[model samples]
Target: MTIVLIGYMASGKTSVGKILAQKLNYKFIDLDDFIEEKEHATVKDIFKNKGEIYFRKVETQYLNELLALSNDNIVLSLGGGAPCFGNNMNEVLDSSTATSVYLKGSVPFLSNKLIKKKIKRPLIAHIETVEQMTEFVGKHLFERIPFYSKAEKHVLIDNKSKPEIAEAIIAQLF
Candidate 1:
């Protein structure tokens, strides 16, 4: 079945997903990359230009369409907040042959990893101080955990190598 990896920002979804896909010989799809490809812009740019609501609508539409076309062997890496909003979470649970996997990590781990990147992460970009970042990571991760915990499986990832984590997940699922 398709593997849907969901978690907070900087939680290694994309990295571990690629490794898993390679090991399993499946196609790897980052949901953000799919949206970006369709929009011809970065996710941050899409949010800035069309507003978050618009992008979310597009995302919902894409999710439905993808579900209709999915098979039992692709890897889908979802956005950090994708499963927590709207009815998308319920839809994911009901539709497709997708197995949801929550990549669990600590707030301190995420903060340390994301602090160095100046990328399309709009929410955490302005928090420059370590204290602010720590709080940001804590609050965001905490709020999202309730939703994330509903995934079919949970995997703790404590700064291990991507291949090791991928191997563990494959061993579990296969």
Candidate 2:
């Protein structure tokens, strides 16, 4: 079965996913990277040139394509907003072979982790201060939890190492 990691940015989806895939001997795929390869453009470029609406459509399209694959023992790490847009959440939920896992983290923890890499994140790139980052994360999480909470399993990531988090996820799945 496919294991899909869903969570907000800096929730260790990619890092934990790599470890999880390694332990499970599964192939790992980051959905954003998949989109970049398919579109021949960075997600940042797509958002800059075509706008968010266009990018969201492409994200949904590619997500559908990935989910349609019959490959098993595959681990997919989704973008932060992947589940919140369109009917993507439902698509993930409806997939019989896909197991969705939410890498849940507190707003304070996420904000602390994201602050160092804020410039890399287009959505929160313009956020100026830690206070702003914290506030933004709090509000974003409030809006996103409804979608994220639909996951089949959740692994709390606060103060956990990447490997520990991955093991927790593995425990949940197995």
Candidate 3:
């Protein structure tokens, strides 16, 4: 089965996914890294050079490609905005061989995490203050919760270590 991890930026999807995959003995694939490898460009450079529309298109294409893989034991972590665009969320939801988990994080919690790593995130890199980050995250999360809520499992990420979150996911799944 393909276990898809979906959540906002800095919500610990990639980090927790690594631990989850290790515990499950599954291959771990981060969608953004996959895109970077396939496109021969970093996600930051892709956004800077090709614009978000083009990036989203390629993102969907790669997402579909990954989802179509016949590999049974794989854990895939998606970009923050992946589910909110095109039919990506639907594709994941409709896949019989895939189970999705939403690493649900509150706006404040997510904003706090993003603020420290803002430079690494193209989407919120320009955000200057905690207030601005919180406001942006609040609005963004409001828009994304619908898509994220469609996940087969939901794991609250507040006040938990990555390993704890991963263990929670395993408990929920089994």
Candidate 4:
């Protein structure tokens, strides 16, 4: 079975996914990293050079490729905005062998985390203050929650360590 982790940026999808995969003996794949390796360019570079439309198109293609894998135990972490675009969330929901998990975090919790790593995030890279980050995250998360809520499982991530989050996911899955 494939376990797909979907959440806002910095909600620990990648970190918790690595731990979850290790514990489950599944291969771990971060969709952004996978795209970078396949395209020979970073996600930031793709956004900068090819623009978001191209990036979203390729992202959906790669996402479908990963979801179509048969008889593989995989832990896949999606980009923050992946579920919100196109029919990606429906595709994930429709996968027979895939289980989707939403890593849920509050606006304040996500904003604080995002503020520290805004430089690495293409969408909010220009956000310089906590207030701006909070506002941006609030609006974005509001719009994306409908898509994310379709996940098979929901895991609260605020104030939780990566190991704890992984264990929570394991409990939910098993």
User: What C-alpha lDDT, on a 0 to 100 scale, does residue 26 get in candidate 4?
Assistant: 100
lDDT of 2 by residue, 1-174 (tens): 889999999999998999999999999999999999999999989999998999999999999888888666789999989999999999999998899999999999999999999888878999988899999999999999999999999999999999999999988889
Worst 10 residues of 4 by lDDT: 116-125
| Deviation from native of the Cα of residue 80 in model 4, angstroms | 0.6
For model 2, the run of ten residues with the poorest summed lDDT: 64-73
Estimate, for each residue in 10-67, the C-alpha lDDT of model 4 and write its tens digit: 9999999999999999999999999999999998899899999999999999999999
Candidate 1 RMSD to the real structure: 1.5
lDDT accuracy of residue 35 in candidate 3: 95
Pick the lDDT winner. Answer: 4
How many pairs of residues collide in each model?
A: 0, 0, 0, 0
Over 72-134, each residue of candidate 3 has an lDDT whose tens digit, in order, gives 689999998999999999999998788999999999999999999999776799999999999
List of clashing residue pairs for candidate 3: none
* Candidate 1, 23-74: lDDT as tens digits: 9998888988999998899888888899989889988877766666665578
Worst window of 10 by summed lDDT in candidate 1: 63-72
RMSD of each: 1.5, 1.0, 1.2, 1.0
